[model samples]
Target: MKLTSLGIRQKAFAYSMTTLGSSLINSLFSFYYVKLFLNRYRISEGMFHQAQIVFMLWNAFNDPLFGYLQDNAKVPCCAKRHLSILYGAPFYAIAFLLPWFPWRDYQEGDWLCGVQLVIALCAYDGMLTFVLLAQCALFAEISTKHENRLQLIKYNQVASLVGSSSVLFCGLISDNMENIFNFQVFALCVAMLAFGCMYYTGMNCVSQYEHVEKLEKDKMEDASNLSWTSVFYLTKQIVTQKNFLLFIVMNFFQVFHLAFLNNFMLIFADHLIPPYLLPAFVKSIMYGAGFICPQLLILSSQSLLRKLGYYKIILSVFYAELLSATVMLVLGPSHHYVLSMFLVANMVMVSATFSLFNLPLADIIDADLLNYKRSFPLSSMVFGTNALFTKPAQSLAPMLVVTILNQFDYEKLKDNFTHSEQSALQDLHGAMFYLVCLTPICIAVLQILAWTPYSIRDSHTDVAKYIES
Candidate 1:
């Protein structure tokens, strides 16, 4: 548990690899997938939705399966949890390009295209699930002290910021609609970068793995002995807790907010921000600023988090996000369609919320460990099991956004102009309003309601008191 400065930096950089790739892949899917595949490649809207649905189904089994595997992995080696990332990282990098490439031309409404889409989603997301589940579980397992965990999480966030900002660099490539191929090449490079970072982390970060291996050896309970049915039963037992269930609900809505912005921000910019003010590179710059500013705010507000506790701070974040979304919807169109500034504010709020949103979950896990007498595997179970709910929100958001846009004749707007674009543009405007404002406002309200009754902060305090006594 004694982490030197060098170890801390090394571990942070290692984990950053995961976030770098994760952010790149996630940004590509969230920001560019619909634009590239559906808009440029002529992939049908129906096909895009189908691929997401299929991926959701794949995640239903894949997340928990890996969660169980990591929790109960009986590897008499360095770290049972690290095994997934060690093996899965390469596939994670390679599979990301599958959906971007096809043997034949992608035709709208083509069943073959739909089938290819499903296969690609499965391949890419399956490897993603394997690596990410382990990385997430490590957040708890890597450090036991609260302050140390916070430091590590801070490092993790720095990596996340850098990874998310990678999308901005893509603007350096051709942003022209005709340069979709160039965009795909950039995506390929990002994938390789993701793999390289992960590979180094997996190879060099052996200390934590060794520590976890020792803990597993000394543990009394062995989940590996249980049947598959017990997996469901155990997951049900954990999720059925009032505090854990509420956390899951709050996290879901929070992710929905993130997914909305990530998935729709580009399209929203296209409709809301005038081309004269926020060109493609400028939009990327704004997006990067949006992500970075909140991190800086959160870092400066560490004092606020200490004094106010996570509950109040989180409530403030929700309200701040709601207000920002409302302001954007009302005044976004008024400023000559140059609303990139407001987008930065919106990003800051979202980034702040997301950056610290999971602090409670980590505390909740600590409380569970104190009460239930478990160890690192418990972290795996909590984070891994929650993905069943959280992943749905993440997957569903893009589909929902695209579906809404499609209703507004979004596909027609993407195609070569043969008729008046005025009607479609107006519909796009309406869709952007709802996505940026109404949908988030509603989600924020739900998160507030769910978060209000949460007393995990009290639970964490109670555990701290017991330790002191």
Candidate 2:
């Protein structure tokens, strides 16, 4: 079963199609779901809160479970990473469409709406977990060389530029989400496009070394003999590792910051920027920039990524974010243009930084393999465990922001209408400013603290040495 040989560039492109597919659907869901359910559909805050609770609980269980299954299962599709994608992509696409359709017409406080939200979130998350766990596992399995992984990242960000444009495209077709039917039509098109990309990637991309590894019957037998006790021990070992602990702590805050911005950026733009000052089209472009510019920034930063390394680059981004947030806070929200620019820029930086997380994570996986003297990579388990800790931040971010906004009479602004009362607008604006600015300041400080002690020095050297052996 020799796989087709591909040059590095070809492999990178093929591999990155997974990113293109995943990001297309995921960015749409992450950025728009909160607004759609809470505002457009007019679901109550209490119901939204209940859905998040269910989502958080489900999110925690699924990541590690899927990771363990993918890594350990004897099923052919589960054993082969790309095959998993081929089988799972269609289901993932279907899940992406879940929230777009309401199962029933419902009045306010109807438990059916809450049920729909819960099912939408959990279904999408479950499928997403299965597909992406395979994609991420393929990332480590594809190559161990630092240079090779960076190539994959470069191609991925490029793909992300296209995939992430689903948001921009949706904005254009839906007239900034004012038309429900248009948005629904746009989503169906996106789901089809995403499935094609993922399916193509699965069929085309193959790990260069996997065929050789498959020849090792003894290792396969050993993997078959893996048991629950071994799984528990491995989980314990991973969780107890000091560097893994530090990384997840920092990542939790990073996820929280990203979730906050992605979920509510539109709401922020609608409320903070008056329509007369900045046209809806201009705001649409800005919203689109939040998705697109991050890739461009990361693409431009390749030299920095190579020279400074992940730790330094990440810390620099965090500190820069902290400083920028502080400055924005001091300046206040009086200037709508400045506020809008800051919000978009903040999302760009955060999104870009988040994109590079897999690099360090790959390093950690390499370190774990070495430390445990393991024959095979535990990439899925490591990523899944990390998600176990970080995914909750996704649910928590919306809940916290909504709770705070509710305190400031945010319910009254759900229609996204320009308020007539200047006094109420002023109060909501102040609250929004603090949420946008203060959150990063606090998160940056915490991330800096957590990340500073991370001791995975010289990932390139470590990974290169590991691969050569």
Candidate 3:
């Protein structure tokens, strides 16, 4: 039996604590960590992108092994899912901030480049792979009921909003890093304050029967410690499903669109805002919009999914992202009040897109269980695949922005162009439109195409067929 009202509340709090805790620290890393590494180390733009590509390749290498082990790996007393989170949490926390602080400074040439590469391996590859992949796979263990699983996602998302929106606290810390906080001192505080406390919080979840079943299946799969060869065999079996394979392809394209829009925003602020403070303020305004947008979007999602269907919702969100991109481009480095309207629209649309996109994952999961006569753990699939595609967008998007930046040679600014320096505004415009609108447009079409042939919904009628076979 599931927990009662108070019991569920308590468990929710515990899970929320872990979600909020890690998200809080990760949020700090996201907003300030890039500026810290870029400015403090004076790393070249071209090189940074290349490093990200290398990190993606590392994921390609490790995740099949991870997905396999996570699938077939078992725990003695506790659930394997919970065990994965607990054991990896410490390593995850450590590697997360590894890039935030370098052991020592490197010379800014051949030697420095080599050192940077090592740090990327130690920091980006290590932390992201462990924490994200583990936590995402950890979702499968949240609840066995389909609706309950989706509710768990809601709780996780709320924590995400809290964590991400509260990033200003860290921004202030970064500004004061030299004068008061210092480097390791600040890192220690956040690490202890966030991850340490959250680790304790995650321990409170009461195990359920589904968790027990997973453990038993894992034990049946392999009698000893998980080996690399075993994981590959499991993956080969899992991906043979046409529906699952198509979903993966669709996910890659749409998520690539998301990654593109997300990573390229820096270019907008860089090109548009003449005053540094103003740009940040503009960006910060969007955070507030992002904070509330998801909740509001979810209100209509159920009805929408019931009516026009999930696929249509996905396509609509894609168009919304595109509209957001187009509005920003027309507004361009010019600060008309109208621009803010476009921006708020952009935020709402992208925020809503995430909410809309979430409903289908569980639906697909259910479809998988109903059709395949076996369970596929999807937690790893979501985040692990995301990290895979993210490498290309993170590296390439910035490079695209930087190439535009190279247009500004201070000496010839007035003579070469019409009024003032070009400020790479056109590049920013092209990037935003391409990422949010154009890319998603293509992916959205592909997603529709990929899913059209698969009739898992219709297969719901085949319940007796699988049993009778």
Candidate 4:
């Protein structure tokens, strides 16, 4: 379907609502879940960790399954790819509230607490994968024209920024108030907001785009007739594609870099504005500044993106990451504003690089389609597997921080820790320096190396022209 400008804006807005909702849901859990579970409820480290492992493994296994199901699902009055979102949105929002509402009857770290955590998390992850994969698949489903996809992607990025910023409420609450009831109320409110957005997007926004062509019944029967060995063969075929493989590696590094920053941001914050001095609302400001700057930078850099193209943009942002990290390292835990700027710079570089790399992902899918000569939608499979590759990096990031801190004998700052204790504070600062600066630089460099040989330009452009024609 050829979309008018208004149609484009409406579709983009609908698609972005999904991004906004998911981002809010993710930011809330990613930043606060551990603190609430461990400190507030006093869940045992062992039990909580076990649940984390289960969540990871389950997602690793099921993400592709849901992807495949979305690719093949049949339903009346719904897009094949949108079916999951339509059916799964309500379940997803309900599952999101699971971790926050633990069984009060169970004592802290009780076997029941662990069981509840695992079950809740598993359900949450399953529904999350279902809802998100469908939303993500829309990137490929909604439009293949370069400019149209770009418009959708840009809107998605803006929504993502808004969603990430929404978590500032937690920081504000933490800094300005002290009441469990307030926190619970905030959680409930956000949960409903997330659900409403996701439901609206799935029900209404999905129809704005042309749905993928469903395989006829005879074709479905023929596909089913293929031997099960075809599955392994197809998997091998995808993993072996040089461009796709490199994209997967780049995706992993991108996620790993972000994960490292998030895992250690608390320590990084300590180096800049210790919690004793950092009010929650001020910390929220710092986070908001850091989070929003990148999107702004990205929006401004669009002209540059047009000029530099994908590879050059990757190089530019990767080097920027290295430079920002180095400057932050040199600043070495000093003035709050200066430190915040450098931290934000590092984030800008990180987010900018991530966004730049994502611009090529759709192209990579195009390349796959052209090379393989497949006609049906493969966005779900491509993105599904990409999501699979990033799982380990997400799973490993927290553990990486813990291992590094343990190795350095880093002490966690308490409310009672005095400025007079320069030794422990310095040690903590040193850890943050490596985590934010040196390690990320190394990852970025490696990603640069992986991306150097990727030559998707000609093929991607050809696909774009062909699709437009």
Candidate with the greatest TM-score versus the true structure = 2
Q: Per-residue lDDT of 1-469 in model 2, one digit per residue for the tens?
A: 2222356678788889989999899989998999888876778899999999999999999999999887777786876788888999999999999998887876767788899999999999998999888888878877777777888899999999999888888888888778989999999989999999999888988654355655335446766888889889889999999999999999999999999999999998888888899887888888889999999999998887777788998999999999999999999888788998899999999999999999888888888988888777888899999999999999999999999998888888666446457787778878998988999999999999999999876775443635432
RMSD of 2: 2.1
Clashing pairs in 3: 136-379, 137-379, 322-437
Compare candidates 1 and 3 on TM-score and give the better one. Answer: 1
Q: State the TM-score for model 4.
A: 0.87
- What are the RMSD figures for all models against the true structure? 3.2, 2.1, 5.5, 3.3
Point out where model 1 deviates above 4 Å.
Answer: 1-9, 75-79, 176-178, 206-209, 212-214, 218-221, 336-338, 416-421, 458-469
Candidate 1's residue-wise lDDT over 1-469, tens digit each?
Answer: 4666776667767766677667767656556655666665677877778888988888666777777777776653213546667778889888887777665776676677777768877888788888877777666656555555566667767777777766666755646334767877887888888888777666655435455545656542565566778778778778888888888898888777777777667767766666777667766677667666766777777666656667888888888778776876787566744366666677677767877755776776666776667544366677777877887877788888787777877777756423447776776776676667787679888888888888866422332312310
In lDDT terms, which candidate is top?
2
Against the true structure, candidate 2 reaches a TM-score of 0.96
Question: How many residue pairs clash (N, CA or C atoms closer than 3 angstroms) in each of the candidate models, in the order given?
Answer: 0, 0, 3, 0
Candidate 1, run of 10 with poorest lDDT? 460-469
Worst-scoring 10-residue span by lDDT in model 3: 460-469
lDDT tens readout by residue for model 4, 1-469: 4667888788889888877887777766665655556445666656867877887788677777676666544443223545567678778778877877767755556877778777876887788888877777777656666667767768877987787776566567654224666766777777788877777787667532244333345335435554457655655667788988888887788887776665456546755566667666677777666566666777776666555566777766777777776776787666566666666677667766776555576676666767777645566667777777876676566656655664654433433335537887667667666676688678878888888888865422333433421
Over 1-469, each residue of candidate 3 has an lDDT whose tens digit, in order, gives 5545565556556666666767666655544544444445545555665665665566565564455455454553223555555666676666656655555664433346535554654465555555445555544445544344445555666766666554444434443233224555666666765666457554665334244566466555643654656555445545666766665666665545444444444333343334444555555555445444554565546455444555666555655655555555555535534554454455455545654444454445444455545534444544444344434444454445445444543123312223653455344444443443344445556666765665444321222221210
